[model samples]
Target: MSAPNVTKSNLNFTELPFNVSDSNMSVTESLLYDDEAQEFDNEEKTWMFGAPLLLVFGTISNILIIIVLMRKKFRKSSWGLYLTTLAVCDTLLLYMFSLDSWLQIVFKVWISDETVAGCKVYRFVSYFLVHFVAWILVAVSCERIVFIYFPMKAKIVCRRRTACIVLGSIAFILTGVNAHIFWTFSLTEYDGFYYCDLVDNIAELMGPQFVIIFLWLDLSIASLVPFILMITCNITIIARLIQSDRQRRAATSDGAQKSSTTSIAIMLVSTATMFLILTLPVAICMVLSLNDEFTSTGNNMDNLYFAKRIAEFVQQINSVLNFWLYCLTGKAFRTELKAMLCCGRFSRTPGVSNAYVTRSTSATTQVEHKPKDVKTNGQDNTVKKAQDDTKL
Candidate 1:
């Protein structure tokens, strides 16, 4: 897109919030191209068409996490509540991006009808929710770390209400601060699509010095701070897990206990991986946005468009995979999920195929049989043990 036409005096539309139009303000012709505009239209359609799947899968996975965690027994733990919060955050992500995607898909551009106030609200909510979700994941990882380091303390510290309060505060502050973006963003119509742009009228209002300040502020608050906090927490949690086995070896002598710890580590690692994958691309994009050479080209637009789509896809995959990964690796999650899913099966045949049964049987059989020729024996033992455990 060509830069919006601006009067010489109004060349720097960097105003935050909205600046009242002055005589100096003048419209600049759009920087849009005949060919690139067509490509942008096509990309919008592709994003919109694929968005429903992301929303559907993301919504369903988060809902399942909530349902699975809401059981009477499951609710007794703090992690269950954290999972519920995580699900809610994931759902909100889908909800916000869904609107943006659908708008782009249907209109092939941003809608110009929406006022700057409304656009600001949308941006604020989306940005706040993204940050809130990232911090919540950090909280989850820290909670797990606490569980590993001080089990008793974790029981007291990782309360649901406390998490809610902390997360809510973070969301509120982030949202309020991000509302500043709206002051700078004004709607412009290009090829029938309305886009919120900071480079236009608002930048002119704020002037060049204020614009530079705004850029750095945005980078620090939105990207640097959150990234540092999340990565630090995740790395610390991983470090704790690595040390946990050696630290607790004497205390937790049972095979099941050791295995459970390993699984918990895997679950945390998996969750962290999702956040890393999604955020890393966006972070790189943000850095690239500051490059004069990159932003000056049509290629910058392509790079940004692809990066955002990939990030969305990564986030959707993360939301969907949580249940499966937790179920596959964590005995506790598997047990809880199964009970939530097929309550009747386990209800009538109590303890059948439960974590304890599976873990114990596998351990006993492994000890009894030769390692090289143990496949058949292990299978038989697991089945038989499951049956016996159920009968008891």
Candidate 2:
């Protein structure tokens, strides 16, 4: 039996054999191939046109975030620490995924699929970083809850060192959890192209039931649990903010709290909301697509593919929006950004001194009026005042 000469030009499979008794097995071989070249080519056009723009803009935004967050003023903030870490993650994601997309579009190859080592490393890092991003949001929300509900404890608990520990722990834990990807995915060559995809031999090694359980467990931990936690934490923070607003308003109409905390709360809430929206579709599609019964039908395959693409694009948009959200919601952030952009000339702008005085006075007033004795914890008070001044 001779093999048919398959090329890039012709993909027609109608002439392929339909009987198992056929001596020429090229048609049988072609029949087994899942031809998605045309679909991928269309997606490549979209990636080529859009990915470069996102890569450039996202890179610039995250760089600015890092610059602003690195300043001594903002660096002391625990929230600022988390944001800085997130900015780093976003920058890495842009570099990694955008380059991968460009290579796929232009070269018709995935570098990660070229070798077993590349496949394992790419899958492991990609999964670990993604979940790390989600968990960081969770951590940020938890910090905000503490700040709003337990202000006194927040002063001691939410330190830069504490944040670093938390972030490092998340990286370590997620890295360990996703280590199985090193074995789950391997190089699969089909139609002269290699893909880093699941090893079906897993079913033979660990049984199909184990594979199904693993998929479900991964989906639950990666998306479902984190999504729920973020939502719950953000909701509680908002509720506390509202309660505090009402009490403060009733006590003194002129006692306007500085917009710093309010602005940060708004930004975090918006971020969490975006995370939920962008990630939910991907989670749902993953669950459905992984089901044996659903995939075996082959009817909803195109719809599932389209849904996953859209969901993934939405998720990528999440990495680019945080910087803009800070600019939009935080007046302090804009001032710092302006200063950085103008080489410190913006600090000499008229009324800047008065704004600084008003902010300092407001912070002082809040600290002095507190029921707790500031003299007992003067150092904590001073740190808190400095943090308040630098708030975004």
Tell me the lDDT of model 2 at 391.
41
TM-score of candidate 2 to 2 decimals: 0.78
Candidate 1 lDDT by residue in tens digits, 271-377:
76666775676667666666777879766756565555555545555556676766776666677666556642453222312232234324322323243324454
Worst 10 residues of 2 by lDDT: 1-10
Which stretches of candidate 1 lie above 4 Å from their native place? 1-48, 107-113, 189-194, 199-201, 204-223, 247-256, 259-265, 347-392
Clashing pairs in 2: none
Off by over 4 Å in 2: 1-42, 348-392
For each candidate, give its TM-score against the true structure.
0.69, 0.78
Q: Rate the local accuracy (lDDT) of all candidates.
A: 0.58, 0.68
Model 2 scores a C-alpha lDDT of 0.68
